[model samples]
Target: MKAGLSLVACVLVAGGLGAAQDYSVVLPTVDVEGISEQDFTKGYVAPSNVEVNKNGLSIKETPQSIEAVDVQKNRNYGTNDLSSILEGNSGVDASYDTRGDGIKIRGFSVDGGDIYRDGVRDSGQIRRSTANIERVEILKGPASILYGRSQGGGVINLVSKKANFSPLYKLSARAGSWDRYGGMVDVNHVISDTFAVRLTGDYEQGKSWRDGVKYRNKMISPSFVVTNQDGTVSFEAQYTYDDAWRVPDRNPEKSVYDAMGISYNKGFAHNGDFVKDTLHFLRTELNAELVHDINLKWIAGYRKASQDFDNFFAGTYDVNTRMLTQNYAAQQTDNTTLSSTVLLNREFEGERVGHKVSFGYDYSIEKREPRLKYQRGFTASIDPFASSSSWNSARYDRVSTHNKHKAITHGVFIDDLITFDERYHLLIGGRYDWYEFKSTDINQNSRSYKDGAFSPRIGVLYDITPEHTLYASYSKSFAPYGGNGWVGVSTTTNDIQNLAKKQTNEQYEVGLKSEWANKRFMSTVAVYEIRHKNNRYNPDSNDPYLWAQRDEKSRGIELNLLGELAKGVYMRSSVGYMSAKTSGDEVYGYRNGLELENTTHWQGNVFLRYAYNDLWYLEGGVTAYSKRYHYVYNDAAKSAKGAHLPGFVRVDMSAGYKFSKHASMTLAVNNLFDKEYWRSSSRPGDRRSFMSTFVYEF
Candidate 1:
């Protein structure tokens, strides 16, 4: 089947190259801050302007490292999810598992409390879909001045597709390996001279190469916009549902398995071991602009989400008996969030100095209810080399517990961009936040805490010429204990600790931004060091569940380039190097100078797209990563020899042909060489795969 598909793709590409013609493709206008309408079909270069900072600054003027991924163009490369798109970026490590999507920026984890949609905080417990996403913007370094109580690593903001004045209709179908199939629809209509409505939706269902793994995802979003002389008002609502069932696959130690005369690909997971997860999400947003001169803006958003997962995973392998134990756990959580922001912007003109000032007040309240159930020995032991028919034969011993948590946050921030002599610029910003957290356990034990923090940022930039700029910046951020959904605070239990203090992060950075080929291309190089304090970690290896406070530090350098390399040829590439290690006194089991787990020392990605005429195009890319330790405490004596996952490089290629003015098709081959690598210490990465997609516009 794979050979047949490859042949078909090659034939299509060969035929398309000879019959290709000059075709100018235009897409629907995207309604986003700092981005203007343009022909995206020509190149993958994204706009320089970004709204991630909330202060309205271009990439070169922000004195920070920033990157944007154009999801529309990435679709042709078989990039369908947030993790897949982020994995190819500089200084970002992203992966997806049964727990949902996880990301680390600059060697720091940003899995929760640092993700947003349209500038509003969104839930990070579930896998995010790209069906309704227009583009993803990443801001590197501390961002607490504009966003309160977030990870110091950085922020990921998803720009949602919104209703616009232009009329558009599109339909698409896709099929890939492992019986994967899906469809999508996008429609926009003008209801009146000043009103427009848009709807977009997609449905996907597929099985995985792994045994007994299946998933289904569906989403629908409807939006309406009203335009007038004074300003524009818009409303948007979205609904998303996801369901999945899969058997956990944990790769065993090759040395031990091979020594036992067992096959490397032998499966240890029983049929009963499974993961079942479901999520339901609903969101509504209202944005209005009152005055055009000062650019007064108001945004109100509401989100309600519920997620449930039930799973049993294989644990501890008894080397003597070659038997694997099963662990069962289940959780159900519901979340509700209400957020609002009001901002005012104005510019003061002066002969020698000019100032652009922006100030905003934002408030948010979130309530979460989570219930959990678990059992240590849920089922009987299973043989590593034999299949088992026992499934759910045992019941959970621990009863479910209902817990409630609520958080209320209010922040006020102001930023001023001062331009001096039309060549030098200075940026100053500060934010103050008041946070309150309340929690109630199943036994009616209640606790409340209040905290306040002040975060500040400063930067300076000097334009050397029309195409080059140099900048330096310093920033700080903070996050309260148990702020994100993953952690919980309890007054009656001894498990919760360090309730009086908050985690803090500080960073120092310097960078240069340059434009080439008459502003058709851009490159940025940045070097930064970040210090994190009050980090939670397990101090005792014997009791791995115990949590204690520690400190960590990371220093990294990154280089990123994007835009057209030549006429009809475009390229995007990046490389990053980081040294992440623990700091301060050595704890009981952890030693100072130990590298952080799951962080690689070197990573890089390079992609190039060549337009073989206007109607046909070909793209190829490579992503590589260095070896990473799976355990935080990498004691050579305790760890298995050659236990660390080795470095790997994967290559991918895609070809697209415009068959007609209204139709097109794309074929993508991932892992072209069928490389065998481990995604994590226990999980194997996907083998070579192929996907084909067809789209029509009306």
Candidate 2:
């Protein structure tokens, strides 16, 4: 695990080795002029067209380190939601969990890979919120050979928002600073030339900079499409619903020297200010595609996702008695997910040796249930309306377990892309998966486990001209573990039967992709090495725990830049050098173990944009973090190393105007100067926030 590779060859020789600049600095100049007279030219489209080319479902073609977040660049940089539009790029990072929207790519988290939409499978597996996105694709490394069981860190595809034949309409609204608010409406209708209809809706509310945080959310998505006439056959249906509410743990723990609060403890300020929970989710998707131009093709899909969660917080905190509390804890949850997919696309040698073949099948099912409650003599000084059912109910804790988890997966895949005379090319793929798990508790007693796996991938492309391309690839992956949620509770600690082994990964890559001068801009450079095996740490089995097996390794180097470095200035940047270890672990028993926590060595992002004539636009950006270590102890007073968490820089600015072409307005400033950070290892990251937005178009 230590492929910092001389720190990525010292940041590409300080951004000067193998030179890759098309332009950087020297900006200003508006006017798109028919957007450069488009005739198909904009970052690799055609992964089945629908504006394709975002990296064409990546996996190889320069094999790893892919990033994309361009849906009109997330609306000219207002970049609302989805964690600041995926903030920095490269290997990505955007922390804040414990129910505050999570994202941690590369260093794992975000439920370890494979979250898709548009390529199916996007139930968001719990703790959710993504407002029916329309862009965001990241495939860094070890993609379980393209979505099988996941987690060698790499994969995130949320591209939903389609249905635009022509006629369109849009409406947007946002207001910020604490009492936040939101609005959105996007509709596209072309009920003719083959039919189409797309609708999107959104709503939001806020108040959580710190004191008794608050939140509210709503989302609705609708879609239907029908097209057939030379363009293959297409039929689609979609429905999404989301509702959210929060106010848990209600941060508010100021106590550095204490005097600033003369009133002593303000610890449990929730009761009247915040302390709530609610969540609901529903989804349905159905798709079908049959393209018959004789090149052979077929695709099918179906999905159903459901979720419900209700929780009540505040368990106990007195700090100094500046408050009163009793009756703590509550939870109720239910989840369901089902998925299916089938695909086939073919063309085998004939037409000057440009062979292509693809076949795929997938299935997923999940179910979960959780219910826990304990409340006794609740009393935060009663008064302001009591009666949480007069409190008192606490007993269930013989481990108070409840389980209902079921998972099944079946997969078959084959891919081959060969083009020998076009300038040497070859792509290969293989997949086979059969996994199953079933459990039923709460006395209903039942258990089951099954497994089968295989995955492989390979790629090579060298066109070197006609627009540069040099690539390399190798991939393999398999990760399965009853499907998440394993924090041991029965069967003598760290249970789940030895963590159900089935985790393996391998990835090696090299890259270069280019477009010079005429293509308007594009660049990429990648290097990667990834490894993981066994990785099932189970012990503490019902207490004194004692079960172990582990493995890990992650390596990196990536740099990416995107288009239009001229003409009203447009830019995007990425810099990354990652390190993750634990290769061959055995801690306490002496083995490979060291590294993991905050996971970073270097991370970066830079964005610059400007516009003046469509009535003005402006943008600025910078993001950085470096410094790792937060846990893994060998007794430094109970084990702690490199307790460093200081290395952060943020700057953001925004401006927008266009009071005509159908109205517009925008204003933003985030952390502009009020820098204060702590992306949640327990909350604190919201210093300078401000936003204003409005728009309408037809």
Best by TM-score: 1
User: Which candidate gets the maximum lDDT versus the true structure?
Assistant: 1
Prediction 2 TM-score vs. true: 0.31
- For 197-252, candidate 1 gives per-residue lDDT tens digits of 88888887786666555667777777776543222434445555545445545334
Model 1: residue 7 alpha-carbon error in angstroms: 62
**lDDT per model, in order?**
0.71, 0.56
Error of 2 at 502 (Å): 18
Superposition TM-score, candidate 1 onto the true structure: 0.88
Q: Which residues of candidate 2, in runs, are more than 4 Å off?
A: 1-65, 68-137, 140-147, 150-210, 214-371, 374-401, 404-422, 438-440, 449-513, 517-570, 573-606, 609-651, 654-687, 690-698
- Candidate 2 C-alpha lDDT tens digits along 1-698: 14334433443343342123231210000011112111112222212112111212332344455676654344333334565567556666665544434565666555423566555545433445566655566776765544677666776766666554656677888887878878888887888876778888888877755545567778787766654442233445666676666555333222221322422112233343332323332333222222221121122334443333333333334456434343433445455555555454555466677766666666666555655443344334322122334433332233244666666677877777788888888888878888776766678777677878888889888888868778888888777752233311233334566666677877887888776578666777887777777766532322223456677777788777766677767667788887777666554334355665556667787877676356766778888777544543453344444444556778878777777778777787877897765553434456787778787877
Please, what is the TM-score per model?
A: 0.88, 0.31
